[model samples]
Target: MAGSYGAETTQGERYRLSFTVGGLLAPQGRALAEMYLNRMGDGSTERSSQAKVSEKISEKANEKSDKNAGEEVGESIAAIRQQAIEENVLAIRTDSANRRVVAETTRRLSALTVEELAYLAGPDSSTSDREALMWIAMCRYYAIVGEFAGEVLKKHYLTGNTHLDFEDYDRFIADKATWHSELETVSEGTAKKLRSNLFKAMREAHLFDKKSGTVLSFLPSPSLADILRKRADSFGYLPMRESSL
Candidate 1:
């Protein structure tokens, strides 16, 4: 299970692609994905220049939003593009093995369900994608949302339980000293980061109830379900454990 983005340092804060997961699962995300492909231009991805790609994506993004929303679309798209780049879904090589490549190109954009894309965009959307996207995200955060958290959630928060208790978080946090292979112990700062990455994003995505952090049922959006219908095998773990969070 490959994870998502690594880590991004803006104003001295360490954030993952986790913050923007909801946006990618929303209706707007479909448009964003389409715009991303369109910007690729015949799949050759001649658009290697970030400034140029940003300008074009921004223009397209502006066309579909209110003045205020439009203002942030470019930045948002650029961020997505950057994340995609980090994930290796996009390539920016001029040439390889005498194969000269001048700029960035779409490397391996998967045709995904809204749910799958959502899961990809959001770090903790589903157990399956969580496994996959979590790895990609780990490259940046240097933290692992490994089986320990999942196992704890299953044993303590799950087991005929559909909801979660803060105690579960406390347990995970207390025992999260071995998540990342490279880290000798999970630092307070790192645990806090995991909280933000896992719990916070899960809340926003409606995977857990706000007040209690209770586990939620799995209900794919209609559009997402339709997309998943043909790709069920790719996500064979449906009807997943509610506590897989």
Candidate 2:
């Protein structure tokens, strides 16, 4: 019986190995059958272990690839956000500089005589024309404030018909009220903030009487134009525009 059993075992191992190898090599279906009851348990255990090992290796490779991809994407997003923040900071700085320049120019131009300002407006310059001219000059003043205030200031005083009476000047000031509405529309909050700062500066300079709602027309005003012009002369800005006075 032992000899018979050994012979059966040998035949069964050969049959099972042949069938498995044939299934891998052949294009036709050579499906496994549980005819080899003696080897069934061991064969099943070996195949399951091989499959689990392959699955673990594939899972680990996929996990590593995903982790690397996530890190790269995170770094890219962080770089873009940092660049945007830097650009916004630069823009804010530029805008703040522009506002300061405008405030300084307006303060200086407000000191000019109405007659001196008339050249900016033409002869028969209506209130609207004068205000438009003043606005233009004020804009130009800010644009060039750091470079050319003094020569421009002298030219303004010298070129205009500076003989208009106070009543005519008062009319010019009254016309400026129309500009308030226009300014409010265009600049909105910015205009109001600038106006407040300007008025405060004027008050401190004694250029206006806040209590009586009156403007003092005769105080020798601090002139940014003159200050800029002097600085420009030291830096050789005299060649740009000859001093008219």
Local accuracy of candidate 1 as per-residue lDDT tens digits, 133-245: 22222222322232323454334334667666656766654554344332334466765555555555445345456686576544454443443444343222222442332
- In candidate 2, residue 8 scores what lDDT? 16
Total clashes for model 2: 1
Tens digit per residue, CA lDDT, model 2, 157-190: 3454223233432343245435333322434454
**Whole-model lDDT for model 1 versus the true structure?**
0.37
The TM-score values for the models, in the order shown, are 0.42, 0.21
Q: Can you give the lDDT of residue 87 in candidate 2?
A: 37
